[model samples]
Target: MDAGQIVEPPRILARRSGDGWVLYMDGVEPSYVRRLDGAIERGRVLMEAGKVPGVEHGAVLKIDLGDELNQRVKTSTQATADAHKAQVAAAAELRRTAAALNEHGLTGRDIAHVLGVSPQRVSQLLNDQHARG
Candidate 1:
């Protein structure tokens, strides 16, 4: 099997002893038993029924079943690209605003305060625009 592929066998929940996790199947088929044993041997925390085991909180578990993972990866990449585009747009707008402010004799610090960004960032924007030409 490929990496990140979890063969779904019949699984039962069992609580771990003193924050240890164990998966106790009702009737252990050969395949299921092998996987379960592998999981256990791998030091994976198994949760017994009605037991609170400490899993890594705030961890993002991405289970890709069917085409869902591929679709999600595409969507996420698109979102990241869109966000970067938005930032570039915003930076361009800020440069325009800074130019207008400069034309009106506004200081970089004043422009930064108005734009709610650091004065250093305002300077960088101005410098970047100058560099493009």
Candidate 2:
């Protein structure tokens, strides 16, 4: 195969599946196959002449792996999601606690002290409940 055989390189695509992930690329054209076959034939001849170097890690190309990439992408995404869920849970709990305290004869100021929030915030909570009712 001639070096000028392939006009363009194959495009690669990565996609996630239910089980894991898969990668796809353009199928090899006839010219590309002939090109690769030529390379393989060349390699075969080199091997016949004992020209191949000893197998070693240093012989292959090195690249960045999952560990070396932006590890924060996954971690930060999960952390942000967890934080949002916590914030929602805390808000629901606060509403329940405020209602319970109010029913037990605690004033807005007392509820604020117990909850460590401003009394005005307690007033707003109570007012919201009142408005809803």
Question: For each predicted model, how many residue pairs clash, with residues at least 3 apart or on different chains?
Answer: 9, 0
lDDT of every model, 2 decimals: 0.56, 0.55
Q: Which parts of model 2 are misplaced by more than 4 Å?
A: 1-71, 129-133
Worst 10 residues of 1 by lDDT: 55-64
- In the order shown, the candidates' Cα RMSDs to the true structure are 12.0, 17.4
For candidate 2, the per-residue lDDT at 114 reads 97
Residue pairs with clashing backbones, model 2:
none
Count of clashes in candidate 2: 0
